[model samples]
Structures are given as structure tokens and as C-alpha cells.
Target: MATLIVTLSRLNARRHATAPVAQGSQCRTETIPMPASGDLVANGEEIVELLADADCWVAIGADPDSSLATDGTGTARKLKADVPYTFGIQDGEKVAVEAA
Candidate 1:
């Protein structure tokens, strides 16, 4: 199976903060497993039913003081950020699935 490196970035950072993927994104020295896409649909056709804003569950909880909050919680305390995931598809099926 293929592999992917998912990363996150704090959009509310006062200074320039991003991940390596684009900018301040994070890239581990090792390859990690693919995370749950939060996609519970059995098929793509049913995606039409999950049009609600909360239908797609993204991030939750908080960022904590060790996270971006180290600088200042201001807005980071609310776990505000962006999730940019990477993956591949072969023959219309999602490839590079990681083991649970």
C-alpha cells in the first residue's frame, strides 16, 4: 500500500507558523500511520447526505499550553487550526491504507 504524511498548521499564530508540507507544516523523521479521515460513509454517493457543517468531524478538544499556546492562548486555546491530509487513489479505491 502507498503512504501519506498528514500534518497540521496553526492559522491563528501571531508569528509565521506553518507545516513543512506547505510552510510551517510538520514532517516527522519517521513514517507514521494514516489517521482516521472521519469519513463514516459506506459509499461516496452518500456524501450528499453529509452536507451539514458539523457532518464532517474535524478537530476537537484543545491545543493545550504546550502547543501553540506556549506563545499565547489568545485564540490557540480553542484548538483552532487547519488539517491538510495527503493520500492516493488507485482504480477509484483509496490506496495506502495503514494498519490499525
Candidate 2:
């Protein structure tokens, strides 16, 4: 069986706040900087590394403070904000957003 490392960042329910990732006996927390991407910014390269060995699930809650750009226009300024976005990753599957 593979291991899954879940890290919490500003993208979680609490803006700029993070939670601990506790699994079995391992306990560690790190403050991740929001990314240049959209709302769920922290779900970046590091998260991908964690799920590399297993089918993974990212359980992010909604974030109201997100300054997401309007639609595909990308008109809104890329505000320095954080939001929550969750996704599941299966090994060998293309890692990207899926249609709702």
C-alpha cells in the first residue's frame, strides 16, 4: 500500500490559516505560501509529490475569501488570496481539473 500525505494550507476553510496533517504517528505542519494560480493555490507541486505513490484524495473546503477571476476571461486581477479546491488523483491519470 502506498502512503498519502495531506497538507493543509491557506486554501483550506480558514484563509491564511493552516491545519495539521496527522496520520498514525506522524505530525507536522508547515506554512505554505499561496501560489500564482487560482483560489486553491497551495495545492501545487508539493501535493503532487505526496500523491505520486498512491491514488490520492484532496479534501479542500470552500473558501469565501477567494478572488477568483470572472469565468474564463481572467479579467479580475490575480489577487493575492486563497481558496479551497478539492480533487482526487489516480496513478497515471492526468492531473488537472475535471468537469463538474
Tell me the tens digit of each residue's lDDT in model 2 across 1-100: 3223333222123344464222233222332223212132333222222222323222222221223334653222221113333233232222211111
Let me know the TM-score candidate 1 reaches against the reference structure: 0.19
- By summed lDDT, which 10 consecutive residues of candidate 1 come out lowest? 46-55
Model 2 deviation from the true structure expressed as Cα RMSD, one decimal place: 14.1
lDDT of 1 by residue, 3-97 (tens): 23323222323445463222243221222233333222122211111111111222222221112334543221121123333322112222122
The segments of candidate 2 whose C-alpha lies over 4 angstroms from its true place after superposition are 11-50, 56-100
lDDT of candidate 1 vs native?
0.24
lDDT of model 1, residue 22: 26
lDDT of each: 0.24, 0.27
Give the poorly placed runs of model 1, Cα more than 4 Å off.
Answer: 13-30, 33-100
Q: Would you estimate the TM-scores of all the predictions?
A: 0.19, 0.19
